[model samples]
Every structure is written in structure tokens, then in C-alpha cells.
Target: MTANRELDDILRRAADGGRISPEEALLLYTDAPFHALGEAADTVRRRRYPDNIVTYIIDRNINYTNVCVTACKFCAFFRAPKHEEGWSHPTEEILRRCGEAVDLGATQVMLQGGHHPDYGVEYYETLFSAVKAAYPDLVIHSIGPSEVLHMSKVSGVSIEESIRRIKAAGLDSIAGAGAEMLPERPRTAIAPLKESGARWLEVMEIAHNLGVESTATMMMGTGETNAERIEHITMIRDVQDRTGGFRSFIPWTYQPENNHLKGRTQATNLEYLRFVAVARLFFDNVAHLQSSWLTTGKDVGQLSLHMGVDDLGSIMLEENVISSAGARHRSKLTELVSMIRGADRTPAQRDTLYRHLKVHWTPADDPTDERVVSHFSSIALPGGGAGGRTALSVIDAQ
Candidate 1:
């Protein structure tokens, strides 16, 4: 068969819910026509979410500490063990952030941070439990397999035990941090000290079995090959086939700024959208795919809704990691609702588990919480501090 025919066949097969191999995925990524590829992926999305409703979460990424031992080359967020700038939030400060998130209509709080050597599983347990005790309703979707692995090594405990302790301490779910690119070459080149890609998956699998579900993420750009990109998702697909645990797959571009790996490479808009289409068509088992507007910008994020993106990840009340790496896009709750509505899909506020909390069926009924803004300069300061503004004061300013 000719190349066009083969591409059409693969697209048709995938759109119809048939699983595509990594090789086939690479072909679609590199050779398939963009519009056709997107349509096929859209077909798959419709199959999964027939209601044509797009979902978003209102959450805050509370970076607990900047003192990291595993200094990733692509990271502009972490500080060395005792860097003068390094800081870890006190439990009261963390609780304050959580309170801010709740007041802004956020349903979840992602406790993102670096691997501080001093922090063992006990640290997370204490923090998570404290947050839960303060706000029992806020979903504590924090950390990932990489952090879990690091904690296990630090605390001299098994991986399973670490996850169990955190879960018992009220870690609702794991966010997909530390999954830069889940292949040997890129993973090692970017984050050499972090756990292996396989080990990352293993930790996630253990979390799934332990009844603590999580999400899968991929950091694009960072000088990875096209084949390696496909390999990354394929690895996640293989694991998803086994455990059926990953709640979503969020692939975002690498923001290179103020970091050691600055401008070495970055995924373009076309590359990001094509990969989103390809990932949706490829992962038959994963239930949701998120568009990372934090790194990719809002226009592409809006475009992704039709390209098999079911979730426009959080109208993040605060995000520091990507913002620290030069991601400048900021969004508001009403603006996000308008974007989803403009895309011809009903916008719904969802919880961590993808359950719809509220649906905006008409423009007049859309939410109007001005305080639910993305990383404002005054808010997402360095070192996970909530800057000098009190949450309510910020709200009053709005």
C-alpha cells in the first residue's frame, strides 16, 4: 500500500478504538496529515466522552520545598541542599495555601516539590495528614513515583510501604511529576539522579495496586527523538494495560528558561498538538488526556479540545515549576469557562477523579470567581512561599 493509504488505514483503525503499536504511533506522529490525525483522535475522544463536555479542575500546586538533592538539568525550580534561597514551607503556611485554594473554588491541592534529602516518608505523612485535618474536603493529589522512590530510599523503607503511609496520611492521588521523558536517553540526560523510567512505572503500578491511583505525565522537548516520544507513551500504555490505574495522561512541553538546559530544545506548537492527537489515539486504556496550557499557551490549549483533549488541566490558582521555567500564560476561571464554551463543548468543573462537580450549560451561569487566577506574580513567588499577600487580602484586591 502507498504511504497515504497506510496512514489512512492506521488512522481509521485507531479512531475505531483499535490499539496502535509504537511504530505505528511514530508514523502518525511524523508522517500523518495533521488535520486527519486530529479528526481520528477526536473520533476516539467522542467515543469516550460522548456528551461533548470539556472538564477542568481548579487546583493549586503548593511546592512544599525547593531544597532538592536530585537537581534536574531542565529544572529552574529546585535549589541545592543548602542553597541560600532554598526553603520548605511550614505546615501552617501549607495550610494557608490550601485554605486559599478552597476559597478560590479549588477542589484539589497538588503538593509538588523537589527531593529534599532531609524529608523522608514521615515528612510527607505529617504534612499530608495536617492538610487533611485542616481541610478534609480538599483532595491532596501530590507527588509521584519519583518522589515516592526518593522517600523510600531516604526513609529506608520499601516503596509499597511508603505509598501506604502517604495514602493513609491522606494523599488522595499522585500527580505525574518527575516523568520528564520515560526513556533511557532523555530521562537520564535530563534527570540523571532520578529513578529509572521503569522504576517510575513500577512505583506507579505499586500505587495502583495499593488502591492509591495516579496520573501519567510526559515532558516534551528536552532534546528527545521522535521515536523516543512514542516510546514514552508506549511505556505508559503497557503499564496501563496491566493495572488500569492512571487517571489521565498529561503531556506538556519543556519550558527552557533560567535553567541549565536553557533553550537547548523545546517542543513547538505543531509538535505538541500532533503528539496530543497521537497520544489520544494510542492510549486505548487511559480514560483522560489533559492539555497543559501552563507550558503550551492558551490558544493551543483551546485548539487541543477538538484534538482529543478532554481536560484543560487546572485553572491553576498557583503554579511555580513551569512558571519558574518561563511559562508566562495565566488564566482566570471565567476566561477558562469561556474558552471551553467557545470550543463548542459544555464546560464543567471536575474533581480529581474526573467527576463533574458543576456544569455550565449557559454563559449566564458560568462562574465568576475573579480570585481563581493562574500564577500571579505576587502569588507564585520563589521557594513555595505564598509571597507577602494573605489569601483573603488577595481576594479583596480582586
Candidate 2:
């Protein structure tokens, strides 16, 4: 058989919902025609979601601290311990942010931040328990396996015990923050100080067994090859096959700015879109796929709706990590709905677990409040330009 014929067969099988092997996924990701690959992924999405409805989540990313022990090469958000700029929000300030999120109709809070050397499980326990006590209606889909590992080591406890304690302290679910790239070479190249990729997955598996669900994420464009990208997905797939703990697969591009890795290389628009389609086709076992407009532009995000991206992700009341790394894209609730409608898909607000909370069937039903915008206080990056302060933190005196 010809090589073209083999690629065609793989595309057909993927479009029909057949599980594609990692090798087949790489072939489609690299060799298949762009439109053909996207079409196949769109077919899969329509099959799973016959309603033709796209979803977005209203959530705030509450960065509790900017002091990190593992300062990654690709990150522009972390400051070393005792650095003049390093700061941790007091428990009262963190709770106040949660209160603002609740008032703004945010159903979830992603409390992610630097791995502070001083913050043990006790710190998170106090913070999370306080948030739950104040807002029981909100979902606390915060932290990741890396944070869990950090806390375990900090407190001298087992990983299992750490997860159990956090779950008891009101950690409803885990977000895939630290699973940057699961492949060893890329994972180490970017974040060598972090826990190993295997260990990250192990912590997640333990959390799953403990009955705490979570999401899986991949950070692309850190100079990894096509094969490594597929391998990253394979790692998550293998674990998902066992625990079924991952709720969604979120793949985003790496922003290169004000960081050690520098702006040497980044994922192109074509590469990102292809990965989105390929991710949808590859992870048949995973129920939902989210597109990241925070890193990628809105056009790419809106285009992803037709290319197998079911969720547009959060409005992100505040996001400092990616913004600090030079991601300039921002959106309001109204603009988000328009983007969905412009793509010809009905817009629906969803919770952390991909559950639809509100659906806007017509223009009249859409939200008009403009304050629900991304990055309420724009981040003042290293070089500095606009915006007075970083996200989820008190705005510095202008």
C-alpha cells in the first residue's frame, strides 16, 4: 500500500471514533492534510456532542503566591524566596478574592501559584478550608500533582496522605498545572527542578484512587519534537486507561517572553490548530477537549470550535502566569459569547466538571456586564508597560 493510502486509512478510522495508536496520531499530526485532519476531528466532536453546543467556564485563577522554589525556564511569573518582589496573599485577601469571584458569577476557582518553600500542606489546608467555609457553592478545582508532591515533601508526609488531607480540607478536584510536557527530555529541559513526569502522573493516579478527580494539561512549543508531543499524550492516555480520573484534556502553547528559555522557538498557529484536532482524535477515552485562548489568539480559539475543540476554557477573571510570559490575549463574557456565536455554535456556561450551567440560545439571552473581563488588573511584566500590578494580587500604587 502507498503511504498516502495508509494516512487516509488512519484518518478515516479516527473520524469514525476508532482509537488511534500514538504512531497513527503522530502521522495525522504531521503528515495528514490540515483540512482533512481537522474535518476528521470535527466529525468525532459532532458524534460525541450531537447538540452542536460549545461550552465556556466562568472562573478565576487565584494565584496565592509568587515565590517558587522550582523556577522553570519558560515561566515569567515566579520569584525566588526573599526576593524583594516575592509576596504571598494573606488568608483574608485570598478569601476576599473568592468573594469577588462568587459575586461575578464565577462557579470555580483555580488557586494556582508558585511552589513557595514555606507553604506546606497546612498552608493550603487553612486557605482551602477558609474558602469553602465562606463559599460552599463554589467549586475548588485547584492545585495539581506537582503541588501535591511539593506539599508532601514540605510536610514530610506520603503523597497519598497529602491528597487525603487536602481532599478533606475542601480540595474538590485537581487542575493539570504541573504536567507541562510528560515526556522526559522535554519535561526536564524546561522544568528540571520540578518532580519527574512519572512522579507527577503517579501522584495524580493516587488522587484518582482516593476519589478526587482532576484534569490533564500539556504545554506545547518548548522545542519538543512531534514524536515527543504524541508521547506526552500517550503518557496521559495510559494513566487515564487505568484510573479514569482525568476529566478533560487541555493543550496550550508556550508563551516565550521574560523567561530563561527566551523567545527562541514557539508553536505556530498551524501547529497549535493541528494539535487541537489531533488531541480530540487521539483521546477518545477523555470526554472533553479545551482550547486555550489565553495563550493562542481569539481567532485561533474561535476557529478551534469547528476543529474538535468542545470547550473554549475559562474567561479567567485574572491570569498572571501566561500573561507574564507575554500572552496578551484577553476577553470579556460578552465577547466570549459572540466568539462562540460567530463560530455558529450555541454558547453555554459550564462548571468545572464540564456541566452546562447556563445556555444562551439567542442574542437577547447573552450577558451584558463588561466587568467580567479577563485580567481585571493587567500584569506588569518584567519590561513593564501598561497595567499597575499582577493578577489576583493587590494593585500596586499607580
Candidate 3:
């Protein structure tokens, strides 16, 4: 009875927008009823966006180079910088992708890559400049704190200076890549060569203070403890309290296939839903919480809508990183809107900042543009990229 009352108290506190400590969050995650978690989280989501409209983005993840110096064991997409198969796409080639994205009604382009031994700040500055010059309208929401740290080291410049230069050269915002698990022990176990969780937040703080906002992400199921999971979000919430620059919080499970950390530890669907619910309760200050349909299937993604996720990630035109590891979920613009609709929420297309571009209140209102698709594996990455389709080639029959 005492334990049940504890769960009841936590749910009540969470539903009322009260802050749950790491211990309480862990408790709720481990014991609270699933639907209760969902109900409380849904209450929070509705409070955040009373319009009852769910949002999604039209974008493509462009992996500029798969050649990496930081060979994190959990990654399957990165090739050693000297590997024969490694390559880097030319500026013109990347520009062609941006052109395709713009034509397909994509407003954002996610530019992410591994830590190339020689590519420094100038490498990114040039790429950003070229992409922006070609498609000034597309938001270059690219890179992350990890890239910034690596480039700063390669260029022998300050992190602040690197961020300023890149933003000056068309880098609009940072994506929360390389932030696998921000806690120390698990992060070290998974990615020894990557920046520390503190350092990652430090770099993000610099970007935020510099006016370059970004989205925060978590890569779960990396053998981290439930307490550690709460620790991760606790860290993010602390940083957000100071910076207020993270536009959204996105959580996705790790794909442990071809990577070194092979399928040993993966979070279950119940675990994911519990985490999502707790996140909405804990991250009251963060404006948006997005679900990863790319990592979790469309069903789980839709189910997440009732569990506090206000946004479905994107109709990714291209995604090479997770595909190399085994994330095969895929959906087109229409299909994603339909999925959201089936969940009993209206669908809307949003940009990087969570501003709605188009809203579909009725089934007939969904956009009919065939080219607006989750075209992850349609085209082979002729330049330096990963093999296998990014949007799960397994379901390519679509």
C-alpha cells in the first residue's frame, strides 16, 4: 500500500506540473502503471500545446563523411579515416542534395558526420557556405557539440570561435548527435573518444549564449541504468534552465547491430514509453518533446503521441548513421500525417523552430505532394556515405 501510494503521489505531482526529483522519476518509471504514465504525460502535452495538433518536420539527414577518427564502439556507420571505402562528398554533390530537398518541400537540412582526422572548422565553414549559397532558404540545422569540439581541436582554435565562424558561414542550429549518453560511466563505456557529458553541455552552452539554438537528444538503451537515465535528463534540464536554447528534447533507443556494442542492451517499448512520460513530467521547461519514428516503429511513434510527445521527428529524406547500425523504420509525408491522425491528433508540418508551416485538420487536408517523402534509401550515396538504406531498407517494398 505504501509503494502504491508513492506511485500515486508521483503521478499526482507529475500531472500537476510539479518537479520530480531523479529518485522519484526513477521510481515512477519502474513501478507506475503504464496508462497512468500515459495519462499524466498526455495531460502535460496538452498543457504545452492546447491546440491538440501534433507537429512534424520535412527534412533530410545528410551525412557529409563517414570517415571518422573517433571510432566509438556503438557506431556502425563510421569507417576509419584511412579505410579504402571511406570518402567525402564534394560541395557540388551536397548542393545537389539540398536542391532535391528544397524541391521536395523540405525546409531544414540536417548535416552530420563523423570526426574526420583532417577536417577542421574551415571544412565545415566551406560546406555550410556552399550549401547556404545554393539554397539560402533551407535551414542548415547541422552538426552538434561533438563536431564543434573535434573541429576546435583540429583547427587549434577556441570552441567559441569555431561556433561563431560556422554560424557566420550558414550553420543555423546544432543537432544533438554524438550525445549518446551524457552520464560519465555509460558514455565512457560506449564512446570513449567522444567529449564528456559536461564538455558537450559546455559547448552547447557556448552555442546557446552565442544565439545558435539547438535540439537536445538522448541515445538510450546503451547499458545505462534507470538512475543514469534520470541523471541524463537531469543534466539536460539543468543546462536548459541556464541557456533556454534547446528547442526540443528527443529520445531514441540505440540500434546495436553491426556496431561493436552489438545487441546486448536495448530498451523495451514499455521502457521507452515510461521514459517519454517521465520526460514530459520532468522537463516542464522544455517546449517540445519529439518521438523517433526512425528508431522506434511507426506504431510506437504514434503510441508516443499519447505519452507526451508533441512532435514526430521527420520524414527523413536521407539518414545514413543509424541505418548502418540497423534502424529501418520508414514513412512518407502522407503516411506520417495519417499515422498522427490515426492517433486522434491533427497533423502539422513544422520547421526547426517548431513553427507550423502547414496544418492538417482533416484527412483531405493532408498534403498530396508525392515528392515530399521519407526517401532514405532511394538514392545510393555515391559520395562518402554509408551503405544500406537509412530509412530501413528492410521495408523498401513501399
Sort all candidates by lDDT, best to worst: 2, 1, 3
- Model 1, residue 314: distance off in Å is 0.5
Give the alpha carbon lDDT tens digit for every residue of 1-398 in model 1. 23599898999999999988899999999999889989999999999999999999998888878778898999888889767778777888789878877888889999988888888999999999999999999999999888898889999999989999999999999988888899999999988998899989999999999998899999999999999999999999999998999999999999888899987888899999999999999999999999988888889999999899999988877777887888878888888988899899999999999999998888887998676677642234443333344432121100
Cα lDDT, model 1, residue 96: 85
lDDT of 1: 0.87
| Whole-model lDDT values for every prediction | 0.87, 0.88, 0.86
lDDT of 2: 0.88
Task: Give stretches of model 2 more than 4 Å off.
Answer: 1-3, 381-398
Q: Which candidate would rank higher by lDDT, 1 or 3?
A: 1
What is candidate 2's lDDT per residue for 1-398, written digit by digit as tens?
A: 12599888988888899999999999899899888888999999999999988999988888888889999999999999888788778878878878877888999999988888878899899988999999998899999888998988899999988889989999999999989898899989999998888989999899999999999999999999999999999999999999999999999999998899997889998999999999999998999999998889999999999889889998887778888888988888999999999999989999987878888989898989877877774454332222333444452211
- In order of appearance, the predictions have TM-scores of 0.95, 0.95, 0.94
